[model samples]
Target chain A: MTYCVGMMLEKGLVFMSDTRTNAGLDNISTFQKMKIWEQPGQGVITLMSAGNLATTQAVVSILDERTKAHDERDPSILAVPSMFQAARLIAKTLKDVIANHAQVGQRADSAFNATLILGGQIAGGPPRLFLIYPEGNFIEAGADTPFFQIGEMMYGRPILVRAYEPGLSFEEAMRLLLVSFDSTIKANLTVGLPLDFHFYETDSLEQGKTGRISADDPYFLAISQGWGEALKSALDQQPTFEF
Target chain B: MTYCVGMMLEKGLVFMSDTRTNAGLDNISTFQKMKIWEQPGQGVITLMSAGNLATTQAVVSILDERTKAHDERDPSILAVPSMFQAARLIAKTLKDVIANHAQVGQRADSAFNATLILGGQIAGGPPRLFLIYPEGNFIEAGADTPFFQIGEMMYGRPILVRAYEPGLSFEEAMRLLLVSFDSTIKANLTVGLPLDFHFYETDSLEQGKTGRISADDPYFLAISQGWGEALKSALDQQPTFEF
Candidate 1:
């Protein structure tokens, strides 16, 4: 399983993903899920994927090849003028990739296909976040739905639903994200440590902050420690029942 | 779907379960999952189940008959001197119920099995908690593992993992339990409001502090509000970087 989250906040976009991939309990491996496309000051976009690791990697490779092969004239995430167009392009690319693979071999089902979080900005457009479905169509994040998550998501969604706000500080948002991810990691062995992510700032628009985060990373450790303490104390203050 | 938990603490034991039962998303109904069989000074045993209502109901009904029949001749949870024996009896009963039903026109893979949390104290014995399996086998909660959860449990486990202690005050434990349940409710529509439960103090050997909880309950509202604010603040404090 995997965990990828996209937070479309008032300031900008926050996207994160865990690197762990496991075929079984003993066959765990690290695979970076966050993919980025950049054109310096013109455009910047990130794709964080989950499900059917091979399919995600295939779609990403095709997109990357399109961007590199000028004569191929294939539409690409960085070349798209608007976020909507970029999302549509991604969906089409995914659909095409799955179709191409299915024609030669396996079909898309529970074991195959992919889901992705596409969030970024082109020079003239506002930052947007989209949850691209397996069928390829996507929904943009709305104010009421400020964030989107895919794969192993339920474990972390309560925190996002209960607390997320557009004006949250970058650090504050990171803290919430870490705690959410922590809860997921603790409950699920498939969604492990060493997160992969990129945080794209609003007009500063480059590929953004990127890293391979570990369990012992200072920020993650702080959120985990602070949250555990908060929960303990919060429970301590509630009224007791009379037997 | 359900959210049932049992905790064995130094002070005593706490058991809680929601009453919601659903045949499908649109066809949800209420059915109490908690059951108590007390012989006052002799024993106090409680079981909270999560899974197929039919199978669990059948198992509990038979267990009820055993106690009423003065089943000293056959082992029963209420008649067992040791909590471990009680767990074994509960498991064996569940397995028997499932097996019998499966043989008579029931679906082969019935999804009819249920998991249970059985907790209480029997006079001279210490408070005990067991996570009863769908197969009728169960494991006792240890000092390091003081609690167990069944059914739609991942969403709510964060608080319990963070707040639980061997000797937490009853109020603290209950509050933590509610917070955990609230998280479960927010994430899964199957496990719902109007919970049914009670706490059993060690030697009290009776159903103590029993109640039916709803979404509008005051204590719950307070926890949700406080938790939301705390989470937002915590999220806001995390660090973000400029691309």
Candidate 2:
């Protein structure tokens, strides 16, 4: 299992993803689930995935291969004219990978299903965020829904609901995303650090800050520990219930 | 869908449950999911259930009827010798009710499955808590695992993990529970207000305070609004992420 989130802010798009993957409780490994394709000053595409690793990796690899082989039949995600077209390409690629796995006689079709969060900006278009489904359908984030989270989402959702604001700067949004990821990591063993994150500043037409936060990252540790104490104090400040 | 939680504290036991029930998203209703069977000065057994409404209602009805009919062949849950036996009785009743439903040709076995959290104290036994599964088996909560949650549990769980203390007063416990329920209610339309809760003090041998909190309940309203502000500040107070 994995936990990943993509947020649309007034400034731009923010994305974060955990690195943990497990075949079973005993078979655990780390795999970066955040993929970025950039054409500086022209466009940038960031994708965060959650679900079957094979399908997600296949989708990314195929998109990457298309960028290298321009003569290939498929268009590169980086070459897409708009974020909408990029989302469609990724959704189609994800659908094709899962369908191909099913054709190989996988016993369960759901075993190969994957969901992705696609966000970035093209030169002539505004920054956009989308949640692409395994079925090749997608939905964009808007004012009513400013963020998209995939995999192991529930534990970390309440804070996002309460704290997310459209005007948040990139740094504040990063703090918010880390706190969400921290809550998820504490509640579920399947989602752990190091976490991968990418920021896309609106209209930059290029990738912004990006980094990997390991288990020992001080900023993450501070947020993880600080959030717990802060919650206690928060509850303390609330009016006491009367029996 | 429903959200229910039972916790063991130093002073007593605490239980809270939501009131929403739905057959489909379009078909919604409110039904109490918490039931208490008390023999004042003898014992108190409280059960909170989640899953198929039919199965839970049947299990409660059987237990209630058995208590009313003294001459029934099977021993009443009220007549059980200890908290352990009461838990076993309830589990068996739950399993039987589900089996009966399946025997009636229910297409999906899970359609009639239900889970319950049983907590209270019988005369000779100390306060006890057990999570009864659909298979008629159960696991008791001990010092290491002081709480149990059932159905739509993930959203409300992190706060419980972080803020729960064994020595909390019933009033404080109620505050904690409301915060948890508030989070769940905000995130899931299927789990709504008009929440129900009961408290059982150790050695009391009877139910303690009980109440239902409606959507307009002032205290709930305060906590619901206050928590959002508190969380925002909590994130604000955390060390800034240096991008």
Candidate 3:
């Protein structure tokens, strides 16, 4: 199990991913789910993955090879005309990688699949986010459902739905996100920390803010404490019945 | 889909269930999910159901009939020796009911089933709670896992895992329960309200506190709002990018 959320905000984009994977409770392991592709000023692409590790890594390898080839050849992250096309390239690569694996006479459990969220900005266009399904097709994030979550998503859904709005403060957005992640980690053992947190500005044109929050991080502690107290206070506020 | 939670607290028990059932997003109806059997001063039992509505209703009907037949034939809740025996009776009834419907051609899907949480106490024993599975067997709530939830459980699970202590205040417990439900409702379209909320005290000698919370309930509104702000505040307190 994993929990990864990518929020497309008016400021830019907030992408966070947990780094825990397990085949079963006994065979747990930590694997970073965020991949960074950067040519510094020319273009920056970040991909957060959830689902099968092997499948995701294979897809990542293919994308890496493509970008490396782009330097010698043309059409790179540095060269892609639009974020839409970059999403397409990712879908095609993931599909080919998955299809190749399927051609062989074997398959892992229902888990031998992966979901990826690709969010980035080419120098000119608006920063964009796309949720790439296991199949080659993908959907661009809409204003209505501006957030895309993959992996153990339920525990965090309410917080996201309630606090999410287009013009939320970066502080507000990030705080709500941590609560979302906190809710998930406590409930499901499969999702764990040091989480990868990235904040991108709408037109910064620069790479943007990056933060790492571990299980012992200060911000996490405050949020967890506040959330606990908040529940107590909220409960006190509820009208009670005579027993 | 449904969202029902039953907790065994030192003070007694808390049971809550939403009142929405749906075949799909388009076909939704309000069907209450909480059933109470109050033989006031002797025992007070509450059963909350989730899963297939037909199956749940059938299980409730069977339980009800056992009590109705207590005259010259046999006694059910009214005749049970203890709360444990009551749980056993419910378990056996569930098993018998499912077994009876298993052979029927018209009820192919009935076998898929409903899960129920039976919480209450009979005088002379501690308030006991059982999570009745589709199978005849059931397990009592433990200190480690003091709460049981059925149907659309994932969203609310995270919240419960963190806040559920046997000693949480009744009001606090209710708040925690609602946040948990809020998450489930936001994520899945299946669970909704007018909710049935009950808080039963341990050894309170039969009478318990119960309330019906509507969608417009004020306390509920405060918890939802405060929780959202609390989450955002928590996120804001985290440290960001560094040199």
- Every prediction: chain A TM-score: 0.94, 0.98, 0.92
> Taking the tens digit of each residue's C-alpha lDDT, what string does model 3 give over B1-243?
899999988888999999999877899999989988887778888999887787788888877877787464365765677878888888777777677777766757554577889988887777888899888789988877788889889877866775678887787777788777766766778889788988888877665778788889887776666666765554444554222
- What value of lDDT does candidate 3 attain over all alpha carbons? 0.79
Q: Model 2, B1-243: lDDT tens per residue? A: 999999999999999999999999999999999999999989999999999999999999999999998689368888888999999899999999998999877479489999999999989889999999999999999999999999999999999999999999998999999999999999999998899999999998878989899999999999999999988998899999887
Number of the predicted model whose lDDT against the real structure is largest: 2
Least well predicted 10-residue stretch by lDDT in candidate 3 chain B = B234-243
Task: For model 3, state the Cα shift of residue A98 in Å.
Answer: 2.6
Candidate 3 regions exceeding 4 Å error are: A70-78, A107-109, A168-172, A204-206, A230-243, B70-75, B99-111, B158-172, B205-207, B218-243
State in Å the error of residue B120, model 3: 1.4
lDDT of 1 by residue, A1-243 (tens): 999999987778998899999888898999999998998888898999998888899889888988888887557667888989999999988887777777776554556678999999999889999999878899999888889999899888888888777997676667778878988988788998898877788987687777777988876777776676765665555555433
Docking quality (DockQ) for each candidate: 0.43, 0.92, 0.40
Two-way TM-score contest, 2 vs 3, winner = 2
lDDT of 3 by residue, A100-191 (tens): 77778676555567889999888778888999988889998988789999998887887688778889767777777888888888778899
Better of 1 and 3 by DockQ: 1
Model 3 steric clash pairs: A11-A202, A175-B235, B11-B202, B12-B202
Q: What is the C-alpha RMSD of each candidate to the true structure, in Å?
A: 2.7, 1.0, 3.2
